[model samples]
Target chain A: MREITYREALREALFEEMRRDDRVFLMGEEVGHYDGAYKVSQGLLAEFGERRVIDTPIAEAGFAGIGIGAAMTGLRPIVEFMSWNFSFVAFDQIISNASKTYSMSGGKIKVPIVFRGPNGAAAQVAAQHSHTVEAFYAHIPGLWVANPSTPRDAKGLLKAAIRMDDPVVFLEGETLYNLKGEVPDASEDEIIPFGKARIAREGKDCTLIAWGAPFHTALAVADRLAKEAGIECDVIDPRTLRPIDETAILESVAKTNRCVIVHETWPYGGPGAEMVDLIQREAFDYLDAPVLRVGSLDVPMPYAKNLESLVLPTPERIETAIRRVTYREER
Target chain B: MSEVKVERWLDDYREMLLIRRFEEESARAYAQGKIGGFLHLYIGQESIAVAAATTIEKGDLVFQTYRDHGTALALGMTPEAAMAELFGKDTGCSRGLGGSMHYFDVENGFYGGWGIVGGHLALAAGAAFRSKYLGEDQVTLCFFGEGATNIGGFHEAMSLAGLWKLPAVFICENNQYAMGTPLSRTSPLSDLSVKAAGYGMVGDRFEGYDVDVVREHLKKAIDRARSGEGPSFLEIETYRFRGHSMSDPGKYRTAEELEERKKKDPILLILGKLRDAGVDEAKIEAIEDEVEERIEAALKHADEAPFPEESLLYETVTVEKF
Candidate 1:
């Protein structure tokens, strides 16, 4: 297995998919000569030419709808949003056209398009540019929401999303683009199926579940809990949100008898809330304590580094929640 | 002027008549509570749809706003399917899922109707992009009210169509009002074609009531698109005889204004042209009888059509297989 950066893995996935299928093309603002706003599409224009790797104006709604239309008429377009925060401008197109066309047209139309970009808070980037949209999109029935945390999952899930015969909202972690990890040198046919959970770390004392960037925080917290207090944990990353890997999550919860769901999104109606509800309903009788949730504060992200750090799901906060769930002594 | 063949002119006349009668029946159905949701009648604007449908070939796609029955009918969707869709029956074009606001007959190149004002314009441009990307000689006709021209999406879509030289004809049906908001109140300019100048595409305006004029101009625009020249913008000056939807009483306009606009009704204009071309009263009567019979058959079929099975409710939400 060769190690690669998450950004490079994404670029490879785009390159391989576009080469495999002529119907696959990329379009967004600055995707051509500019490579990409984040360089995820670097060198794509030179490889695929200007026709397939299109550079659009600063119009999300226009380009998104164009992608849907192209998909309807035999084209698999990969539309980049620069950031999920900017996806608001094109939300109507995603919800109305891309998501609903398959059902609205009575199965006559399928919008096989991918809307991908960086998501969640990045460093000091304030409220407007920082948003975790997995829950927002997962709420929609016709869309498949992919929140990939690692370089391996990012490449595999993106390739699957491009080939899937439905609209996919690929929410990549903004801070994880440069993170290095082992990405298999598999052929174009390799794809990590959706609705499968990956156990990042295995233990029996308690379950610490997270996805996207927060998965790293959960892992760090688990390591600290073990090293400092002799607490072992099961860290699970549910790769896809819509068709969630409920079996893996519930099995872990049932085994550990306690769970602490972690995420960087807001606390109210966030990914953690959905996981908590499922755990309480299915794994309630096996629980030693209530299923706890760890998420950002119930407010918009702040620009100040101190306030932003306070708002996000840090390792210390996750560790505190894990100890509380395991009934360990306070530090 | 080119001589309008009697048979082709009659076909257009009958097609327009079919739309008029179908909408009138739809209004009747709405009144009786047989149809639910927003029922937008294409009563007065029949000629634009007829001309647009007759001009474009089978491969060219058509996208329009909520007032889409006329376009669907003109594009050769069976009257039964359209009526059943309004009736929310399984036999409907959308299998009863899309109702009146959304109708799709993709096989015949009708991408569907959207209830959102200017949202479909971008989607239409996308379809046009597909044609250009694949090197297919197909054109797309997108219809929206003048009010939609004021929306931000309209600018985004039109700009991209111009920038990319997509094969799409952006037709603005300046039907005077958009859901009670007059074009004068919302639009910066009464002449919507001027907006096209900003996008660098050829802009034109015409009397929408005259089917011949609509056909002639639309043919040229469609030809231009198929020939890889680029998109064209047209503001078809028309009026909606009915209120915006079944709920509106249209009290904003005076009875006098309504009467004056009706005097130049598109159906009547086509009829007058046919009579002037020596189409005898017997021929007119025969066409009316045939249209009436078709409407009756559609109505009866729609009335008897079954409600979609409950099992189908969950289907079509996504592809059945990978």
Candidate 2:
């Protein structure tokens, strides 16, 4: 198996999807000639031409809505939000129109549209560009929220998302793009459906559930915790946020009797709340101690590196959460 | 200069009658607590829909605002389905799921009766962009009222539609008021057509009541768009005969102003033209009778239509069950 970057896997998925379906095309602010703001769509315009690799004129709301409308009329469109923080301008279309079309049309129309882009904070982009919205979009009933932590999952889940009959919000993390991982060649029978979480690392002492960038932070702390205290942490990446991998979470919690959820969104009303609530309900019998969630501080993400460090979930915060869950006595 | 024959004029007259009678029906129903939710009507300014639909190319896409009965009727959506949609019946265009303003018939390329004021304008532009991208010789005709001109997406969409040279025709049914807020109260320029030039797109205002004027300019814009020219924004100045919806009291605009607009009533003018064009009195009567019969059948279809079950509401929102 050859190794590929997160960006390359996404590109491969788009290329394959576009080639497979004549109706599938790519549209975004810089998806065509500029090779994308992140270069995920690099070299796409050269091969597919302007027809498939489209360059939009900085109109996010327009392009996104068009993608929904087009998807309704039998064309599959993959629209990039540049950075998902920019999705604010197009949120109405995604929430009101794209998500509602199928049910509103009584199944006569299906919006097979994919709104993809890098999500969550990327270093010090500040408040407007740093907020994570997986929690917000996941709260809605009519969308499939998929965020891939590996190149393999990105490729497989993206292909699955493109071919799916509903609207999927495919959020890619900035920190994971350059992270290399082996990808199995795509096959007809091989597909990763939504709501299926992946166990990145299997362990026994404490269950660590996270997604996107924070998953890496949790892994780093897990390694440290394992080496120092002989405490094994089972790392679970909830591939899809809405359906979450509740089964995986419950099973891990049942075995370990300890749960630590990590995320970059604000701790108050973030995705952590649902995880905390669910574990408290379904996995309460399995709990040895209270489930702790390590997340961004309940305030706007700051610009300064020091302040930013204080705001977001870090290895230290994750380690603390795990230690708390495990009753390590060190905390 | 009204050159439309009696037969064609009668056709549009019937359409106007349908719009009026349907609103009257909706108003009565809403008063009796049958039709629930926001029910915007198109009682007076129907000539805009009829004119624009008749003016554009055969395969052109029509996108409209929440006040969309006229737009649907113009696109030849049967009055029965339109009426039943108001009644929230399973036989409606959207099967009672999209009650009132959220009408959609994608097969006919009727993009919406979108509830969001400025939101669908961009969607229509994107459709037009795709049309040009795929080498399809078609235009996306977006219809919004004057109220939408202030929205953020409207500015962005108009600008993009201009810069990309996309084949989109922006039709603004400027009916003097945005809900309760009059044009004079909201817009400083008051003429939104002039705002099109700011976006580097051509914009013009027209007398919406004069169907001939609307048709002539619409054909010109449609031709310009289909032939690879950029988009054009039409500020079709018309008047809404009813309140914003079925329940409006008609208190915002004066009766004198309403009387003045009545002088420009397109359906009556079309009937007058049909008489002057040497059309037979018997043929005119026959066409009116046919429209009446069609409306009657449509209402009958609606009355007998069923409501969608609650179990059906949970389905189709997403591909997989949570």
Candidate 3:
């Protein structure tokens, strides 16, 4: 196994996929000559040439529609928004066209395209720049939504998203792009299918369910609880939100008799709310206490560092919620 | 007259008549509540679709707005499929998943009848881009109301098409009103073709009531695009005789104006041209009879067709239905 940054892992996936499939091309703002805003597509243009690594204008709706059209006409396009926040400009294209084309065309057409970009708070970037809209996208029927937390999952899930014969919204954590982790030295064809959860840490006292960058907070809280508070917990990371890994979460919850779902998205009408509903329905009888959730404060992320920190979920908050769910009193 | 000219003229006349009759029947069906949802009849603008479809090659693609029954009928979609789609039956072109506002048939190169006013322009540009990117000799034509020209997507899509040299033609049907708002009040420029210069593309305007005139203009534009000369914009002047949708009373214009436009009705205009060309009146009557029966059979088939199974509702919603 080799340790690489999540950004590097994503770049490798794009490079490998483009090499393997000529139909696959990366198109968006700064993807070609500029090598991407965050350089996730660095060296792609030079390696794949300008034709394959395209640079599009700053028209989100236009380019998003172009990606959908290209997908309809037998080319696989990876349309990159500068950030998930910018995707709102193209929401009509994503929701009305990309997500509905398959059914609208009587199953004769498939929009095999991926709309990917950095999502959530990248660091003090403020209100307009920070958004975790995976749940909003997953709410649509014809789309596949995935949010990968680690470098390995990023590469694997991205490869899978590109290969699937459907439209996919690939939400990458901006903060986790630079974070380093051990990735398996596997073949390029290897992929982690959607609707599967990875157990980040195994224990029995309680289960902490999370995804994307927030999974790190869950892992940290679980580690601290075990070492300092004598509480062991299982941390589950649901990589895909649409076809969610409910069985894994329910199994973990049933075994632990406790649950605390953590996410960086808004608490109201967010992914956590849907997860809570599902858990209560399927794993209701096994619960020892009411399932709790640790989510960001329901406000737009502020520009100031302190305010942004307060808006996002913290490990301490996750630990506190976990303790409450586990019925353990703090020292 | 050349044999080919007579044959082409007859084909265009038949197409225009079929669209006119199909729309008339659709109106009747909607009145009877056989068809549901918003129904936009392409009653007056039959020539534009007939001419465009006649000019475009088999491999050429078409993207249209919600008033798309005429366009789909002109593009060789079976009358049965179109009627079935309007009836929301399983045998429809979109298998009942898409009704009038969302008619689609990818295999026929008919992309969709998009509901949003101006949204499909970018999608059409992208389709053209794919054609160019893959070195395919395919041209894409996007048909939208003149009101759509005011939207940001129209500008973005047009600019991208020009900048990329995509093989596309954007046709704006300036049919007097966009759901009751006059074209004059909708955009600043009266001649919508002038907006094409902003995107650095060739611009042209046409009288949409005459099938021959529309076919000549559209043929020239399609040829230019097919030759890799980039996209073109055409603003066709026309009028919608009926209300915007099925429910519209169409009180925006006076009766005199409607009568004046009807004098140049596309189907009557072409039928007169056929008679002047010495095409037999008996042949014309026979064609009309055949078209009437086709429409009748299509309606009957759609009426008898079953609705989609309950499982199909969930099946077509996503690709991974299995």
DockQ, all candidates in order: 0.71, 0.56, 0.73
List model 1 lDDT by residue over B11-37, tens digit each: 988999999999999999999999999
Which DockQ-derived CAPRI band holds candidate 2?
A: medium
Off by over 4 Å in 3: A186-188
Ranked by lDDT from best down, the candidates are 1, 3, 2
lDDT of 3 by residue, B117-155 (tens): 788999999899889888899999999998898888898
Interface RMSD of 3: 1.4
List, residue by residue over B1-322, the lDDT tens digit for candidate 2: 3445444677777777677677767777778777789888887777778887677666778888888877887787888888788789988888898888988776666777788889888778877876876789888899898899988878888887888888989888898888889998889987788898888888888888867788888888888889998899889988887788765787988899889988887777777776777767887778667777877777778878999888888876776676
| Candidate 2 residue spans exceeding 4 A from truth | A186-190, B1-4, B278-289, B320-322
Per-prediction TM-score to the true structure, in the order listed:
0.98, 0.94, 0.99
Query: What CAPRI class is candidate 1?
Result: medium
All candidates in order of DockQ, best leading? 3, 1, 2
Model 3, A216-243: lDDT tens digits are: 9789889988998889998899999988
Model number with the top lDDT: 1
Global Cα lDDT for candidate 2: 0.83
For model 2 the local lDDT of residue B234 reads 88
- Which residues of candidate 1, in runs, are more than 4 Å off? B1-4, B320-322
Q: What's the lDDT for residue A42 in model 3?
A: 98
